[model samples]
Target: MPFTVLTILAALLVAAFLGYTMLRGRRSDEPTAAYDLRVYREQLAGVDRDLARGVIGQADAERVRTEISRRILAADTQMRGEKAQSGPSSVTSAVAVIAVALVLIGGAWLMYHRIGAAGFPDMPLSERLELAEELRVNRPSQAAAEEQTTPVQPPKLEESYAQLLQKLRDTVAQRPDDLQGHILLAQHETNAGNFKAGYEAQRRVIELSGSEASAEAYSNLAEMMILAAGGYVSPEAEEALRQALERSPDLGPARYYWGQMLAQTGRPDIAYRVWLDTLRSAPAGAPWADAIRSQMDDLAFRAGVFNPPQLPVASPGPTQEDMEAASELTAEERQDMIRGMVNQLSDRLATEGGSPEEWARLIAALGVLGDKERAIGIRDEALSVFAGNDNALQMIAAAAQQAGIAQ
Candidate 1:
């Protein structure tokens, strides 16, 4: 109401000022013929007084009177000419003023109509802030509700595997206290890419473990939830991650997911720092290490850390052919093959002192196998070997850091 009043008052003030200016402009400045004639008469009277006082001769008085009359005539003629010109000029000036006023007023109204909430009530800052807080409080619940309503599409499975899954479900239902069974079911479901089922199974695992549940269990459940949501870091998943991080600060999966939450919430700097720190301590070849490495540069850029040195492209791990060849082997034999490969890489780096990239690869492989101690040792040796080569040393250090090997 105050704003409306002020706006109306402003419009009235402008109009009043413009109208006064127009009226004042219409008045002529030149004197009329009658005023000039009066002035001439006063001068003639002064000359008469001079004659009476014997101050001037009659001839001089006549000459002065003649000059005064001449000036009066010229003034009258000039005033008539000015009057003749004033009419058209005054009309032109008034038209220009009216046009300008119309344009200004019309333009203001048009612009306001187009872009402003002309009739909306003014909201106080406190009220606006309160409304924002309300939205913030409700948003997570709304997202969770939406998630619940959305259907989970499970991956297609062979008939035999499907029957087995059904049997497992029935057995679990029958034996609700079987925590180990739930864990196995969760792992197998996740391995088969049935994330929804895996998520539910993992949730049960946490429930069964109770206060004894490890951070890994919470992190595993969170991972399944995230996968089920197709990578969405839903509020529920975020809570699970928080629980995991609280129990184990150095848990790589929790840190990675937390970093993702930070990024999502528009804190790229914090996210970058978290991911960078996590990568530094992560075991080489760890899945979390690769995930962080893949996104580190972009996150760093967003965090204003520009032109960071590029990390070496990760070497391919076990190929499909390798996996297929090992498929026929027993579980123990498969483990032996992987361990042998890791040892061979380790031995080669220690004996041959390979390129910085090769050293980095080996360190990452060790990290992936959860051998942080060995990874750290390899990093120190690589650093010593590449002491004179700053670029190579940096690459080796970065690879080791990403693998979560201690500096």
Candidate 2:
């Protein structure tokens, strides 16, 4: 039902209760005088019975009857007066009651009209509040218009890739001096596994950036070379990595690739060491660290090597003896301490830069650590660096066999 109607009904119920209470009291205030007459009649009967039984004199009985009749007439007259007064008042009272009821209903209707915009019949309070909020945020903007616009179809991935490649080619032709453009092109080619194109692009970037930016370009080129070299590491690839490491001993890419070459040439211990050292230098999220870790796990699984799967970026914390010995360590103790220190250095190379010598050192460490997977990846990276260099490939393969890694 409508709120107004409910409110009116409630008011009427209250009025009825009050009216009943008032009217009920009126009955008590103006009680019937007939009971007084009955009492008077009973008293006269007693007087008559007394005279008949000779229990009282006739004079005494008559006197008591007269007094009772007089009191009964007086009470009857008062009751008539009260009735005459209340009868007219009841008419006004009833009009007042009806007026009060009409006023209550009208007030309820006014209140309902004021609140009727809330759509109480259908919408709930929560929905009404939400609608109010929407009305308040009525800002006009181009973004809003765009949001309302329909979506357009996008090109397929292959078509998009082709378009991007064409744009890259055009951009490179038009803006030959843009080193970033070349880098982007190289990245795209690398992602598409177009190692030749990627290598050429990286070479251009290296030329443009010169030695200053050559390290990054070299890293990319080396990665692509590894992909291009397949399983055969070559001497030329080895020389390129060596030069990169020579320029920057902390060169992570060169170290990682060289480690792979070592593993491929049957030098498992050397390859494992390279990865272990690389891990020490590599940051937590460095791709080299993750790749090396994966390679290590694979190698361990294949070769029955039990190096920890996912070693920390540094060698596990120092041993008690190493800490206590301070300066005078035994040969074995000294080796352990050096191993730990070297592991830390290699991990730093993975993160920062490394020299060719450091790369070599990392390889030896991996061999000691027994990480075949990293060793193999290093070999693969090396072969790509020195493409067409058979000696490099042979060395890598020999190391792999020696490391007990299957072809």
Candidate 3:
């Protein structure tokens, strides 16, 4: 505010100074005809003196007088014309000078008010950085952020699946130290919008993991915490992301979250750099890469990149013909080949139980084949088989969701 006042004052002073100078110059102007007439009189007197002193002949003296007399008559006529033409013009000229001064002062104020920072002092680069750091350190805490956040709606689930979810929670509670139990609980609870419970279960998973924990485990815990806090990165999430990055710096999900945490802490410069590096190494159709791609333009602009480079594209995946060549049974026909692989896998799983992933994959493939009833039956069986293994159950649940049998 003070700066604005000072600016207006300075502009006013300059405008006033210019206007006064112009008006004063105009007022001090003497009539040009009067000056010219005086000079002619002096020449006539000089010619008389020269003639009396015999400095020139009488004819030369008369010729000089004639020229002087002509000039005097012209000057006298101009003076009378000026007196007639010079009345209200002086006042009009003064008014014009004042209007110009007013316009200059008002224009300066208008331009400054339009775009200038009126209250804040000038910010140097170092001061701006310091301000960003201050904002980082003093930002809202996780609980506070959550208090103000509007929660995202959880994925809808059928009542039967909800009952099963409750049973799984009960099962996890009965087996407090079961690593798989907590993993499953965490996944379901988050899906159910019970993020508080989800993050708690996730924390237990991390605790149980101990030294053998992979970077993915830490990242999962961070992701759960971020969701619970409505996307705010609290101190806990920061520590988790740090651990994940330290263990596996190239991990896609971990790097994505790391970039998010950095941006939340007022460091989009570092965040953009981290996200770009992560994108370069991301595999085709990576979910993390998609997340980065959606927000890349805004992040780049915040990081001072006006014309950000184009993002990396995914390479083409294998075609149906390529699949037929790789899997020999596929040569006869595509549909027949798919059924053959599914039947073979089914026969193997029926005799010798497969891993949770294999069971989930089978369930999805069955859904793709449009045998939803069969997919549901298989899903229920898998659920029963992995009742004690929550992590396995969670995987199966996802496949079941894809099958459209349950949410």
Best by lDDT: 3
For candidate 3, the per-residue lDDT at 207 reads 90
Candidates in order have lDDT scores of 0.79, 0.66, 0.83
Q: List candidate 1 segments past 4 Å from native.
A: 1-138, 141-153, 309-339, 342-353, 356-407
Model 2, C-alpha of 367: deviation from truth (Å):
48
Q: For residue 14, what is the lDDT in candidate 2?
A: 77
TM-scores of all predicted structures: 0.47, 0.35, 0.55
Per-residue CA lDDT of model 1 for 1-407, tens digit only, reads 65545565566568668866776767656545657767887987899999999999999988998998888788778777767766446577778677767765666666766886687778886885566446534445324643764556666889998899888888988998899889989998897778878888999999989999999999998898887766666678888998999999999999998888777655677889898878766664678889999899889987889876555544435756688999999988987898888887777666755678888888887887788888888888888888899899888878887888755
TM-score of 1: 0.47
lDDT of candidate 2 over 1-407, digit per residue (tens)? 86556677897887787777666665555347757767777887888888999998888877887898798788788767766655436776677677777777776667777865434566675875566445434322323433454433333459778888888989898998899999899988777766657777887888898758655556667676666655334454555677677778787777888777666555556677777777777754556766787788765553456765556454334455556785687878767777677668657666775444444445555565677677666555545654676765566555555555536
How far off is residue 357 in model 1, in Å?
Answer: 12
Lowest lDDT 10-residue stretch of candidate 3? 312-321
Spell out the clash pairs found in candidate 1. Answer: 281-404, 282-403, 282-404, 283-367, 283-403, 284-364, 284-367, 284-368, 284-403, 285-364
Expressed as tens digits, the lDDT of each residue in 279-349 for candidate 3 is 88777667888999999999998899898878656543444555867676544476666767777677778
Off by over 4 Å in 3: 1-117, 316-407
Q: After superposition, how far is residue 46 of candidate 3 from its true place, in Å?
A: 34
lDDT of model 2, residue 331:
76
Q: What is the C-alpha RMSD of each candidate to the true structure, in Å?
A: 14.3, 28.2, 17.7
Give lDDT: candidate 2, residue 227: 62
